[model samples]
Target: MKLINKKNKKYIQVFQLFTEEEWTKSAKNYNKNISSFFSGKKYEIFIHTNEETVTYLIGLGKSTMQNFEIQQVAVKFSQIQKEKIQAVPTLVLADFLKEKQFEEFVKGLLLGTYSYPFDKKHSIWNPKFEIHFENLSQKKLDAIGTKSEALVNGQTACQEWLNKPANLKKPDILSSYLKNLAKKYDLKYTVFNRKKCEELGLGAYLSVNQGSAYDAAFTIIEYKTTVKNAKTFGLVGKCVLFDTGGISLKDHNNMHYMKSDMGGATAVIGTLIYAAEMQIPVNIIAILPITDNAISERAFLPSDVITAYNGKTIEVLNTDAEAG
Candidate 1:
């Protein structure tokens, strides 16, 4: 195993591209030979080669070809990182046995490379090579490495977006940042003016914005996918990005963790970016309903019957739950 050291940025850069080719090659070479495992209806481990070290072929099994869910892969990869193997090539095959029953595997394989320098910090470690695939295709393999690289960049941005304190991550600033991403990625987006939201029957979402000093804005984002004639899916996320309970206030200190309230929206936007980058064949109608709640003379109160854009009326039970 090659140990990571002060000047060794190559190891970090090695897993930059998140793609199929990279996953296959790294898995094939993890050590001269490896075993594989696929877990689905049954937990059966099979040996693909007579190679030395144990390589597992894990199949996601049924429903593997459904839309990609990053969280699932993230959890598994995090588990692998915990094992601390100096370097191992891993390949996860999803629904390779059937067509349409396929979904590509995604993971943050390089997450283990991340570490902060502290007085109690541990020594540097070697890089672990890994890749995931739904099926085999030379063209797709060629693109996988680059896709992985882009995911790393996106994840870095997401981490910063998630870490910002609420006050700093206000609606206006959050929308601005998303706009920047849309422009850079060729995504089509439109921000609905507050008045437009009122006209659109987006009352449930708008009610949450009533107490904020800043006006609320609703965003509609569209990312075209590569799957020819694929049906579009709608992703709606609550973009409280930051939440401060309105007049129905809570302990002042309790609001500290509100920045993460918008995680759903962050994930929605993140998916749009990745889908666009990978040219996945699917259409998405993503809605980011943005706002904040702060107590003011103009703040809405409990018992208010606010109607949502979908014509559903929410009887405000507690203003503190405004982001929901």
Candidate 2:
């Protein structure tokens, strides 16, 4: 989306937002079909067109919505409108909405417009637009654009990673991806191979990786800011790219969905990316224990005792509960 300073009164599509109370008083001004169809019910949209303009009357239940509520409404509105309202569209924001609300609105639109990039044969249409809002400072506009872009990029990265097939993203493949992400932000990146894990006494993690065809790796990423005395946050994400349940096998019905076992790690990466994009003044130390739980003669058996990275002994009671 492009934001322009040039003001234009003519628009192909216009969004008219109204709360229940406001809609009640203004409903009579429109035709009976539109007024009867639209009573400002939350998430309901009524389209009214004349010889001159096409207007979409959107319903906002009340003025007292929380920030997430406003974002939820915007997301729904974006999906409903989809590619129908992007070119030269005018959004008549309700006066009751603050800058934060507007920011959430943009965020929702970007998120809703996003489609999986890998699938070219079938994809949702994302239309770009030139938009101008009234009474907004340059600083506020910049903030909205920056935050919205960061969030969409971050969230999209996680979704794509988590949705990738296990075959495409084995342990080594996942670490390589993380390394590139770290380098993009100039963050410190380190990966401990299977030998290093054994030396570091990360037995519990290694035990789970012993049966995999690919080697095990532990990835650590650090995001540091230049701010003096900045507080640091530590995050640990389990990156079991695929969980086959090893000896204690998972039910076959939903076993394929195990590709999402790395969701935790992808989520952490997403947060790190978002923070880095926003240039947040803080330090983030993230650790990802990456491997798959596969079945083979080398796999750890039940009741085996293993030493964890912290040097604590872990007695494996249930093999499926390796990372649980």
Write candidate 1's Cα lDDT for 7-54 as tens digits. 221221222212243345445544444323322221222334343433
lDDT to native, each model:
0.57, 0.79
Clashing pairs in 2: none
- The C-alpha stretches of model 1 lying farther than 4 A from their native spots are 1-109, 113-143, 322-324
Best by TM-score: 2
TM-score of each: 0.59, 0.91
Error of 1 at 7 (Å): 21
